[model samples]
Target: MPHVEWRGGTCRVKWWTGETLPNGRKRYESKGGFTDEDLALQHGMDMEYEVRHGVNITNRDGAMPMPEWLDAWYASLDLAHRSMVNYESVIRVHIKPYFSRHTVSEVSIMDHRAFKRHLADVLPSDNSRQSVLAVFSMAMEDAVNAGLRKTSPVERHRRRGKYKKKKRERKKDMPPGAVETLARNAHAVFGPAGYAFMWTMACTGMRPAELYGLTREYCYPSWPGSDLRADPDEADRYAEDMLRYGKGDGLLPAIRVERQVQYKDGGLQFFPPKYESSRTLVVPPFLAEMLERLLKEHESRWVFPSISGGNLRSANFDHKYWRPIADGAKEDEGPRRPGERLALPEVPAFAGKRLYLIRHGAKAWLDEDGHSRFAVESRMGHEVPGVEGVYSSMTVPMERAIMKSQQERWESLPDRLGDAIWG
Candidate 1:
């Protein structure tokens, strides 16, 4: 039962919370500042109901500081290395400075509101502010679970329009004939291995990290046999090879995308692909032939290794090779300032495009071929929601359709680029 009384020109409700201390002292909770007795009593009854439903209301003494709680909560999380890196960055740069000294219970709704205002003023992008707020909210939720606070202040702030809709960004995709042009130019500028790498990405829709992770062991090509055909009964053999060699191939040389290379802790690290997008994608026959040639020439373990026979880093490749080829040549002008010179270059039609646009173009090609939604999504490593995703598997017909469509695209490249590609 809850009772309301008039106090300081406002109504206050008193209620007994079902909590006891070490010394057998019962805890009573109170809420104040209601305009009338009815409202105060109603709020009190709700609080009492929450207490009866096993909500912890004992630790409201502002004892556990936020920094300590955040550290413990972070340590307990079983997150990926990349996700953990983002969490650590948010905690150190945005969260700790503001809330480190304040106890969990002292962070009231008003304080949360103030923090949002501060974030709006200081942060340049809405996405950054939202990310910080999200991590802070998670930390507060952990505090509530630990009996350090009665309720999360973030929940109250959420109801007051803390979240606003952001303008969606338009997807960047390459135009028609762009992929073939880029691949032709890449071969001319960078060499045969670069040509194979670019064509493989465009044909298979693999992420840059996945491309970096490709190895000879994961490449299943129908080579050493001139007909480029796999034995009809080789599926079981391939499965056994996968168990022994960590990667196996089918009749057509398919690439198994089971891992990705990421930069962490000042070095490179290999982890499972994003969202565990582990699937084998059938390669276009012509592209498969090119990859075989590349492997023989390189004589390295990796399917696409750097000049030094090491794992290729996307950043280094982009800055040194991709930017120059995509953007074309530049001539430096006279100095505009004491230490600066102006360089003007004739930009190509696809100047600002990124390597990722090639992957998007691959998906566009699949969709244009009228493949089933499940096939497209699975090939792109996207999880389709609902029963369709769980019940459906990529069938042989789907893989064949994808392979045929991609092969057609590869065969048409010479016509699209004329002498630039065929020469």
Candidate 2:
């Protein structure tokens, strides 16, 4: 029962919260500063109803501040170093300042909605806003689970449709020949390792992080006999070639994508591939040869070490090596424009494209080759949904088919580029 009493021209409602401490102390809560006695009594009754309905309101009156709660929540999480860094950035930059003074109980659905609107107005990209909101929702969910709130205020459903539509409009896949051109140019500017990196990613559908994680030990020249098809003659020839090349007979050429590298804080950190997408992918012979050459020449342990003999950072690589080649520049090749200094020529075909397009190109190539959806998804480190994903495994035929398609692409590259690849 809730009762209101007048004190200093204000009405305060008092109620039993239906809880007791271990020492047998009854727990009660009070809400004060209401001008009307009836209103105060009604407020107290509403809280009592909430508690009766299994909504924990023990801290209703003394809810922890958002910043303090966020810090506690962050400390309790068991996330990877990279993920922890990202979460910290989001909390520091977006969430903390906005919700710092507010108690967990003070934030409502309306407040969340306004925060989202504010994000839309301030953030440059939809992805950024969504990421921040996702972190916020996760924190609020923790709050709800910890009994700090009755429900999460995040309205994910309200934003899903808009996000989906925007995703469709954004770049999905690369145009044909764009990857080959990029690779040739990359080779010219950044050398053989750059070319090998581009080709492997284009063919393997490996994420940038996965590419960075590649090691000499995990990279094989071929698949084992058990995983290969029952073509003894072909296997014999492959074995002979492997023996001649000093590579072991049992190992077939493949890349083991078990981990990924993420640049966090001030250095590179290694983490398991996203969604535990750790699987082996067969590499075409040409790519295997290229990787072999790269490994033999480079003294570093990483298959694709940066120019400074360190872990490859995606941002640094993009800005330094990828952009100049992809976008193009005349670079002191003499002036062409009248009354102008030096001419700046652009690679029209490569301009406005991104390094990530290589991954898209790989997906497109697989789809075009008519590979099984499961095999493609598996190769790309994506989880196939439902029973099909659970039961399905990459079969010999699927592997051979993908390998054959990639082999053809590799064989045709020289003809496609003619003189550009060497120059």
Candidate 3:
């Protein structure tokens, strides 16, 4: 609503600015010096209408420079550490560089498309470009809510699945044999911890963060017992409750996934699993024994700490440990010296594939076993969408079936009792 009042014998127009003052009064923008009261009243009404309709760019925070807005918006976000990192990268590397001279409201649709083209030229894949653009679109949409822009320049119709492009190749699961091969390779590189780490992740379908975050208390046949609570009796009771009441085999080993690790502020930090999907995963008999052995031999709080004996940094592990295991260690520079040749042949099954594929492989194995969709997805730390997720549940039969299938797969492998590949 707008008001016209006489000020110093001239008409003045005032309207609420859609903001409240510090004193809890309505903030207003006013213009004076109109000799005609009706004219002043009309002008105030027009301004009010524009403000109400989101056509007024003069509102608070509407004209901030793009770079400043980007920084402020980023600082205000409460997101996952990894997601924040990606957003920061997209803004710093792509957005701020191009839109540095513009205000939040000044990026037109043409500019948005051009910025996308620029990203296409620089980013390696369509997915990369899309991810970056999604970040920018989110920022612009937020700007509109903050009265920084009337509308986002990013077109919603251009988003993912708006048009079909190409069908992606079906990813293959790592069979028991391939998993063993990777374990052998990991053993050669990281010793027993490496061997067990590969097997644990492959068998459990654990995300890299989840696997890195694994601790002894979460491991089965041992968990709740390994808990370091001050009250030992409480732990004992909890253990009894968990062990005494399940179907199939009450003694079946399981891993309770309560948290995951990620790099935050230059240090490793524990966070709830993605989407807050804290779940307990059941493992096969062989995996249960494997994890128990690994825990016995494991020295650190982490099931698989980095070679430096600290919390595992994903990047460092990927480069130093995983790369050699998957791609095989090439001849080190010492090869140039007289007798310092050192190399490890890469595993063909994992050639050029990322470590996360191990999770994919595990999920694939569960699906191939023809278990209940809910059980499979739940075990993989994913929620089945829609009402199905609400009604469907993991039963003891489903869990037992999964365990049986995996054990059978293990039994099918040759050389099941072979000597260790590496010390």
Q: TM-scores of the models, in the given order?
A: 0.72, 0.82, 0.80
Candidates sorted by lDDT, best first: 3, 2, 1
Off by over 4 Å in 1: 1-62, 120-126, 155-165, 188-190, 222-250, 264-266, 318-322, 329-350, 414-423
Give stretches of model 3 more than 4 Å off: 1-48, 51-55, 59-61, 158-170, 227-241, 244-249, 330-343, 416-423
How much is the lDDT of residue 381 in candidate 2? 87
Between prediction 2 and prediction 3, the one with superior TM-score is 2
Model 3 clash count equals: 0
- Note each model's CA RMSD in angstroms: 7.3, 6.7, 6.1
lDDT of 1 by residue, 1-423 (tens): 998888778988888888777899977878789998888888888888878887645445447778887888899988887788889999988788888778878998888888988899989878889899998998888787877787888855235545657755345555445666565555544456556777788778999888887766567553222221244665664564344322145455567776788888788887888888877687766666677667767676667776556776743777665665566544343212123223334225457666676787788888889999998888889999999999998776777778788877666654643234333
lDDT (CA) for every model shown? 0.71, 0.73, 0.76
Tell me the TM-score of model 2.
0.82
Top model by lDDT, which number? 3
Higher-lDDT candidate of 2 and 3? 3
